[model samples]
Target: MAATLRNLKIKTSTCKRIVKELHSYEKEVERESAKTADMKAKGADPYDLKQQENVLAESRMMIPDCHKRLEAALTDLKGTLVEIEEELNQKEGPEFEEAQKVITEVEQVLQSTEA
Candidate 1:
């Protein structure tokens, strides 16, 4: 039971990290888009515009990839938490049930965000 809880905790921490990284990636994409806009305003050449378009395409792909990673990580973390809850329920003791409820609530929020 202890080991299961520890694993869930680790997964949750990893999911948090994934979320943070994805947010950072989103900010970077926005910043690059702004830069491209500024370049256009400054009268960049057609070739430069094409290069900026390519960069935007790559950045757009990266945002979705990061979002996918975050969703996957959250799913894994939620699964681990559910498993830990089942184990605790079987044993029928202590604070695990309450902890499981909290985790479930968090999982619902994450799942909603993914949808």
Candidate 2:
């Protein structure tokens, strides 16, 4: 039981961290994309525009990578939840509830990304 709870906690932590990382990457990409667009609108030099586009591409790349990590973390969390669901049911509390919430949120993110 102790091991189960510990695993649950670790999985939840990983999910939460990956979620945050994904959000950070998404925001960075959005910001960089906006900057690139603004540069284009301003008739920025071709060389500078290419550099900005490269930066935007790098930021965009991080997002897909982050999504992959989040997907793995989500899978691990779901597996852990399934393994210990019965035990957690008897001990339902803030921790269990939080884990469920994380799962729901991550699922929504996954769906959005897929589209």
Say which candidate scores most in TM-score.
2
Superposed by TM-score, candidate 2 places the C-alpha of residue 77 at a distance from the truth, in angstroms, of: 0.8
- Stretches off by above 4 angstroms in model 2 are 86-91
Candidates in order have lDDT scores of 0.69, 0.85
Top candidate by lDDT: 2
* RMSD per model, one decimal: 4.1, 1.9
- The CA lDDT at 87 in model 1 is 63
State how far residue 104 of model 2 sits from its true place (Å): 0.5
Q: Would you give me the overall lDDT of model 2? A: 0.85
Per-residue lDDT for 62-107 in model 1, tens only? 7667767766776776677667657676433333454455456546
lDDT of 2 by residue, 43-91 (tens): 9999999999999999888888888889999898888887787655644
Model 1 misplaced stretches (Cα beyond 4 Å): 90-115
Global CA lDDT of candidate 1, please? Answer: 0.69
Worst 10 residues of 2 by lDDT: 86-95
